[model samples]
Target: MLLPLRRALLLGLATVLGQIVWMRLATGQVAWVQVAILVGVTAALGTVFALNFTIGHLRAAREEVKRLGVNEERVRVARDMHDILGHSLSTMTVQLGLTRRILETSGDAALAAGRIAELEATARTALSDVRATVSGYRALSLDSELAGARMALSAGGVRVELPAATDAVRPELREVFGYVVREAVTNVLRHSDAELCTVRLGPAWVEVTDNGSAAGGAEAGNGLTGLAERLAAVSGTLEHGPVPGGGFRVAARGPTAALDPAPSKEGEPI
Candidate 1:
């Protein structure tokens, strides 16, 4: 390869130049001034070559790191898409199958109409979720998630309580927390038989705990895993486990700095 040849050339040049300088000095044919100038020039050229090589290597390394990071991000996005679409499609399939069964057995127009309406609603919800996922900027905030959780739980006849003094989460981190809250609430609605859910936010962390038996078939779906990855991307963490008292709990944490608000941009007059 060209690398070996280049290295060999440099070695050969160094050896020959060294011998020539040595011979010139031994024969007294070269003046001290000339020797000094020649040595200084050689040193300067070596330093330049070294710097050039170092810079080139560093640039190559930086580009490779960037490429790897981009690939990782793409993979993460693909996984998230798969999780969201796959679950939605599965639920839709079940609903459609139920509708078909109802249509085949009963010629009841009212029931058929109701099924159709449900299907339409499900489709719309799925479409909205897909849009949000694709946009990447459709991140929900913590306060919004809290409100949504309360509404959803109350609709399900589950009593809910939230903390009074929640920390002011950063915009990016708040989005991640919102996703976690949404996912937890969805899981509870779909799986748990609980009548009570509590959300607590403190200086250390935020947790959503439910007082229901763990569903037999419930597992950490791809959605939850994706949520974890998203949290980690913003230097946050997600933890989930069974609560000793009865139900399940999901929590996320970040540094105190992350909870601070951005400085105001107010200016004196104009």
Candidate 2:
């Protein structure tokens, strides 16, 4: 808004000086004092005009950068919440189902009590995790996920087999690998009617194989899709499909640049 006025002022000063200089030189009567004043005023106004716009542009750029930063933060929070809630809620759903089944029949009261306690524990842990995630303090651990997977799968009456330890995994790859385990097991619990689940973990990869053909149903949910996105962020790959004859397999392999190269699954069925 104000630029044109400032520009005109600078231009007018310069033009007047130019005219005066030409007139004085042509008239053969140059006044050094007048010439100096004209030059000084023109230069000062020119400098002011340039500075005004430069300062304005700098302020505008700063504002734009700040807005972009806020937007990026918002997107990050959204993604975090989606992953956290989706995972925790899905596990809780499976626990609830297990609780219901136990309650339905005149089964062992001790078994029902145990399942109820586990369900309560799962709900409490999820609530705490949600709070932590919102505060950006939550971290995914392969060890924790493994322990939880055993419980979730067991609750669904699926036999569980997990590697004895995950010390072989690189420290940096544990979190994404944890997500892979969580999502895979959650899918098996919520969707399948598998009788057994096999978990295989290498230094740079993790796979969950199950005998559930149509366990809830054969469809990809948001949890699985989100896991794929998370895997991509760490230069990892997610592969899942029904095995040749029967069953389903969900696997994730991390980057080869990590401590150990990704495991080879050359003969694994699609």
lDDT of candidate 1 over 96-181, digit per residue (tens): 66667778898677886776776676678668767876767454467866875675566456799876644645455666666776
**Candidate 1 displacement at residue 193 in angstroms:** 4.6
Where's the lowest-lDDT run of ten residues in candidate 1?
261-270
lDDT tens per residue, model 2, 1-270 = 244766667777677777787877898777767777877886687678679889999999999999999887676566667666666677777777776777787666788788778778878888887788778788988899999888777766789999999999878889988888887887787677789998888777888888877745245566677777888888888878777667888878888734555434442533
**Best candidate according to lDDT:** 2
Report backbone clashes per prediction.
0, 5
CA displacement after TM-score superposition, residue 149 of candidate 2 (Å): 0.6
Task: Report each candidate's C-alpha RMSD, comma-separated, in the order given.
Answer: 9.0, 4.7
